[model samples]
Each structure stands twice: as C-alpha cells, then as structure tokens.
Target: MELLVIVGVFFLLCAVFFIRTVSKKKAVDKAVDVDKDDSYAFEAIGALFTAAERSFYGVLTQSLKDNYVLLGKVRVADIIKPQGNLNRSEWQTAFNQISRKHIDFVICDKDNLSILCAIELNDSSHNKADRAQRDAFLSRALSSANIPFVEFTAKRSYVIRDIQNELHQFLAQQSSQTPSADTKICPCCSSQLVERVSKRGKNQGNTFWGCSAYPKCRYVEES
Candidate 1:
C-alpha cells in the first residue's frame, strides 16, 4: 500500500509540472502575437499617412490634373476625339506624313474647328537631354501645324489656380481671334443646312447639325 501511494504521489507531481510548463509557453506565445499585431498596425498607419501627404500636395500643385484628375471631368470619348489625341493619327494620315513625336494637351473651342492652344507639363525626369530633344521635335511639329504650345514644370509647384488663370486668358484671347462660324457644305446632298441636335439615344438632348431636307437628305454633324 505504501508503494502504491508513492506511485500516486509521483504521477501527481509530474502532471503539475507539465501544466505549469504549458501555461508558461502559452503566455510567451500570446505576447509574441501581440507584438506582431502592433508592428503591422504601425506600418499600415505609416503608409496611410504617406499616401495622404502625396494627395494633399498633388491637389495644391495642380499635378493631379496634369497626371490624371482631368479624366474625371472629361469623358473618354472627348479625350479620344479628332480635336484631341485622335488628331495625331488623323493629321498624319491626311498629310501622308508621320511625326517624330506628339503633343500632350490640345485645347480647342466649343466647335473644335481649330485648336486654340496646347499645354505640356514636364517633371524633373523630363529635364534630361533625351526628353528635351523629344520636346524640341514636338515643338517643331506644333509649329508646322500652326499651333501654339506651352511647357510648365510640376516640380516648380505650379498650382491649380495658376493653370486655371492661364487657360482662361488663352481662351479669352482665342475667342477674340477666331471667326464666329465656319463655312459648312453638306457632304451627302451639297445642301446649305443649319446645325441642329440629334433626337436619339442618351445624346437626344445633345447638340448636332442635321440636314433640313429631313428623310430625303439624311446628314448629321456633331457639335
């Protein structure tokens, strides 16, 4: 009976030791997990702060529009129109010539009959010799096309207000120089028709020119 009692005492002691060791291990693991979570939280907060700083400066410096903010206001169709980026390829094909380079912004009046001005924003990276050569080539092309162009730098902190003022001034000057209307001759029937809007699709209320001959002369020009 004494031997059995001794065996029971030994087993109880072993269990107590095992429980204490497991508890200690669990406490250490919990502390490590807490530290890891804290570190990740700090990193996420730091990234958020950095992104906020960039966005604030972009708004102040007008770089947002120069980069991609203008896309929000302008439709993709407008951007790809013949007066804008699409003019590059159209002009090349029309003249049977290819340009060595291309211009960035092509601002025009409401009618889009003539290009009023072009604006190019350059960054510090574009200050390199190669980029300067490209700019020079694009400038020559603009000159050949009888278009005026301006270059600005974002690194110099050109603000949004500054760009707005410049654009307003240029538009005012262009309006004074351009004629009120262009000579329009109908392509289908050679008739003198007035500009009108299409009464179809989402553009039902939008401006477009149509033939006065109605069903007989089906002609349209977008305004």
Candidate 2:
C-alpha cells in the first residue's frame, strides 16, 4: 500500500512539474512574440527633395502659378486605386506596384483640388532598366485611371513659356467636351454634368463633360 502511495505521489509531482514547465515555456514564448512585435523607430531626415527636384519645383511652380495647384511628391497609390472585384491577394499586388512610386508633380484643380494630371522628370536615372520598368508600370497605371501624364527630361534651363503652353493645352483639352443640355445629367449618380479635363489615357488632354459629383459620379460624356 505504501509503495502504491509513493508511486501515486511521484506521478502527481511529475504532472505538476510538467504543467509548470509548459506554463513557463508558454510565458517565455509570448514574451518573445511581444519582443518580435516591436517596430523600428524613425529619425528625422534632411531635405525631402533632391537638388534636381528643387530646381524643377521652381520651374513647375512658376509654370503653374494661379491657374492650377501643383503638388510635389504625390504617391501613385493616392492618385490611383484598384477597381473591380479584387481578392485580397490581387488587391495587395496592385497596391504593391504603386505603393513606393511617387509622381514628381501633380496638377490639381484650383477650386476643388481634384487631380488633373501627373508629371515625371526623367533624369539620367530613368535610363536605367529598373527605372524604365517602373516608369512603364506607372504609365500604365495612370493611363488606366484616365489621368494625363507628362514626362520631361532634366534640363539645366527650362523655358517658362513652354511650360505654360504645355499646361494650358493640357488643361484646355480636359474641358473641351461640352455636354448638351439634354444629356447634362449623369446617368450613374443623376448629378449635373460638370466640365472636366481628361488627365490621362489616349483621350488625355481632351476636354469632356463629367459628373459634377465625381469621384462619386464617374459618368463621362464626349463633347
């Protein structure tokens, strides 16, 4: 009986030890997981724009002036979003393409601040294979979004008149299509037709009538 009692106590102690060990191991694993969850801290950097970019900003600003709002370093993801029935993986893949790329310049509406066009300053770096591929991807994405895109080679000297003319023509093309009174109402959202510029694609720089409540109303009519 004593021997049986001793075995029982031994088994009980073993069970208690095993339970404590597993609990301690679980606690350690959780602590390690918490440590793994820690993220890298960031530090402040210097100038956001490179010397080439800074020089171009002056030229772009002077060119745009009060006619349009020129914004620098706008992200592609912000300007273009995935459409259609996208699975999580597909959406993630699309997002990954543009997440890191930024447009050198974005021209927006002076009043409502809607994006009108994007510009890329093609420096020598753009000649590289990786940059070329990136440029092509960005171009396709922008085109798909029906946003107009322009590219200019880096130049030591930029003509203000040339910039002005380019912008003027591009903007003019956007609102060139006028909607008739009968078809002015948007079929999608029942909003009134508003004058808008095509910012990208084959019809880029073409002026077309769009939905007044756009971004919500995507209806478009050719003038």
lDDT of each: 0.51, 0.78
Model 2: runs farther than 4 Å from truth? 1-43, 173-208, 211-216
How would you encode candidate 1's per-residue C-alpha lDDT over 1-223 as one tens digit per residue? Answer: 9999999999999999999999999999999888778555433444422333344345434632332222111221232222345567685563342222344455554332234446665667678999898678556555444345567665533467766666553344232232346645568865444454333457866766654333246577876
Tens-digit per-residue lDDT, 68-155, candidate 2:
7788989888888987689999999988978988999998766566677789999999999999998988888887776768888899
Candidate 1: segments with Cα more than 4 A from true spot: 1-100, 173-223
Worst 10 residues of 1 by lDDT: 67-76
**Model number with the top lDDT:** 2
Looking at model 1, residue 2 earns an lDDT score of 100
Task: Provide TM-scores for the models.
Answer: 0.34, 0.67
* Model 2 per-residue lDDT at 73: 89
lDDT of 2: 0.78
Q: For model 2, what is the error of residue 152's alpha carbon versus the real structure, in angstroms, after optimal superposition?
A: 1.1
